[model samples]
Target: MAAASLNVENVTGLLQDCLSKLGFEVYPLKVGWYNSVLSPSLRLPFPDDSLAVVVLSTPAMFEQAFLPFMEQRGCQGLSDPIDQCVKHCATSAVSQCFPGQNVDVRYDYELLPSRKPKFLAQTAAHVSGAAFYYQQSDVTDQPWAEKKMFGVCVHPRFGGWFAIRALLVFEDVVVGSEVVQPVPPDCVPTREGRIQLLESFNFHWQDWSYRNIICPVQTYSQKQRDYFSARPAERFALLRTWGFLPKEDHQPDISSDAQSEMITHG
Candidate 1:
C-alpha cells in the first residue's frame, strides 16, 4: 500500500477489523506521544509523526481467540501459551492487512539487549487512550513512603482484566498535524480511590481486588481466572490434564524475571 493510503484511521481500522472479533482492541497513537513520556534513551527509534497502533486483549480473548488457537495449533515447545497465541493473531493480522508494509512490531514480553522492554506496555496503552495507567506518582500525600508501589493500567470497561499485547509501528506511514493525542480516561480519579487501587495492586495483587476498583462491566470467566492464577509450571500441568498441551512437551518453566515480564497480569 502507498504511504499516502495509510492514516491512523485506516491502519487501526484494518487491525480492528481483524482482531476485534477475536476479542482484541486496537488504538492508534503517534510515535511522538509515546516518546514524549520517556527519557531520550527510552525513546522509540522512529519519526515523531509515525503511525503506531497498540493492541489489547480483553477477557473475551480467552474464549474467542486463545482456546481456538490452542485447539488448532496446541502448545509449541516451552514458550508461554498466551504469548504464542497473541503473536499468532497480531502478526497474522499485520501481514494480512498490509502485505508489503514495513511494520516494526513489538511484543510486551520482548526485551532489548539492555534488558528493557521493547516498549512500555502500559505507557503505550495510556498514550493510545486504551487504558488509564495509574502510577505511584498519580497518588497524592505519599502513602507508601520509602516503599515503592508498582503501577497498573485500568481499562474503563475491562478495568485490570485486560492486557496490552503488542505495538505495531507503520514505519512509512506518517500523520500530519490533524492527528491529536487523546488522554486516557482517569477512572480512579479520587485520591482515596487511587490509594485503594495502589494498595490492592502492590500488597494484595493475588486477591485481584484492584481490578474491581472501577466496577468493570465484565471480568474474566472462572476458567480464565483459574488459568491465570496458577504458576507457570502449574499452568502447563493443567493444560496437559485438559488434553490441550501434549504430555511430552517439556518446555522448561520460565524464570522469575520472565514471569515478571509476562504479557499477562500474572
Candidate 2:
C-alpha cells in the first residue's frame, strides 16, 4: 500500500510473511506448470487446505503483461481475453482441493475498470467457493499517467526495474479519530479511502522513495460513477453463479506471441 506500485516480488514476499504468521507454510507453485491443460479438474500435489492463500495480482489481463504468455503454457493463470483469470483461479481452487476440503485463495488483483469481471470473479469466487481473495484497485482512474508512473520502476533507465514496500499493522486501537484531517470538497470516496489506507499502512520501499511518488490520477466521470454504483454487486454475484470448475472454450486463434512481443518491446 505504500506508494510503490505492486510487483511480483513484493506480493510474494508479503504473502509469504502473512502466511507464515498465520501458521501456514507457503508453497510457491507454478499455476501453469502444474495444470498442463489449463483446466482446474486435475491432480495436484498439495492438499486443498495446504494452500492457505493464492496471491494473484491480475497482471495477466494487461495487454502488455506477461500473463497471456503464462496462460499459453497451459496455465489457468490467464486465458484468452485475460479477464477470466479470477474465474479460472476459482476453478483451480475448487479442483485443487479434495472433495470437501475447505481451502481458500487470496488475490491482490489490480483494479482496472476494463477488468472489472476479473475483479468481481475474485470476490465472488471467494464468496461462492469459500476462498479468500482481495484486489487492490489503482490509485486513480487516469490511464496515461498511471501507466507512466508504474512504468518508471519497470523502466531500465531509471536504474530500477522494481521496488516493494512492506508495512506492519498492529492489532491495536487507532489514535486521534476525533480530530480527523480535512478532506477536499470534490474528492472522490474511493480515491480518498485509498490514500487514507496507504497512509495508514506501514510499508517499506525496496528500491524507491515514497516522496517522489507519481500517483494515478482519477478519470472517472459522473457517468462512470453512475455505472459503477448501479452495478456494485453485479460482478460478485455473477462470478459466484458461474460456480467452480465450469466448462471453458478453447480459443485457439488467440496466441501468446502478441503478448510476449508487447511485454518485451514496451
Candidate 3:
C-alpha cells in the first residue's frame, strides 16, 4: 500500500544522499510534468501531484556499483548483468530508504505487455531536469526529413556519458504547487550543433561521437568502454575474462529484447 503523505524535499534529499555516494543521481518531478509532454496513451497513470524521481548512472556507476555487485552477488539468472546490478542497487535503496512504501519502480530495460518501455527514459530525464533531451523536432529545418529520429538526453555535466537508469514513482507521496519544475540545461543550443548531434546519434551511433558533443566532466573508462563495445550476447564470455562466471546449469544467454535495448542505447 501507499505510505502516508510525504514531503518531496524529504524524499528527494533522502534518495540523493543515499545514491550519490554510489555514483548515481536522482531528480524529483511531479508526474504531471512528464505527462504534459507525452501523448495520452503514453502517459503514466497517476495523479498530477504524484512524486516521481528519475535515476541516472554516471560514469562512476561501473566501478562504484557494478564491479562491487558482481564481486558480491555474481549473475544469478538469464538476464543482462548490467540491468541486474542497477535493479539491485535501486531496489535496495528504496527498501532501506522508505520501507513499506508503494513506490512504483520502473527500470529503463523493462518492457510493458505491449513491449513499449514501462516509462519513456528520455522523457523522464527531460522532465526531471536531469538532462536535456534533444530531438529531431527540436531542430528547425530538419535534415532527416520524413524519418523518425529518436531523441537522446545529454547531461549538463556528463553530456552523453550518463544513462537514464530508472524511475521511482512515489505512489502515495504528493506535492503542491510549490514543487515547480526546473528546466534542463540547453547544452547544445545552436541549430547546427543539434543537427550534428542528432546525425551522429542516428547514423553513426556505433562510433560514439555524439557522446562528445560537449566536453564531459567525466566519461566511461577504457575498461567500461571495452565491456559495452562487445555484443550483448557475447557478454558472458567477456564477463568470464573479467573473472566473473555464470552458473553452469543456465545457458549463458540474454534475451533478444534486452540485447536490442542495449544496442539501441546501451
User: Of the candidates shown, which would achieve the greatest TM-score relative to the real structure?
Assistant: 1
Better of 1 and 2 by lDDT: 1
lDDT of 2 by residue, 44-74 (tens): 3333212222332211122222233233433
Which parts of model 1 are misplaced by more than 4 Å? 256-266
Candidate 1, 1-266: lDDT as tens digits: 67678888888888899999999999999999999999988889999999999999999999999989988999887888899999999999988999999999999889899998899999999998989999999988987878988899999998888899899999999978998789899998999999999898888887888889988888999988888887776778888887898778775766655335433544
Better of 1 and 3 by lDDT: 1
Ranking of all candidate structures by their TM-score, best first: 1, 3, 2
Best by lDDT: 1
Q: Cα deviation in Å at residue 145, candidate 3?
A: 2.3
Identify the superior model by TM-score, candidate 1 or candidate 2. 1
- Model 2 scores a C-alpha lDDT of 0.28
Return the candidate ranking by lDDT, descending.
Answer: 1, 3, 2
Cα error, candidate 1, residue 109 (Å): 0.4
Question: Model 3, which residues run further than 4 Å from truth?
Answer: 1-5, 246-251, 255-260, 263-265
Backbone clashes for every candidate come to 0, 5, 0
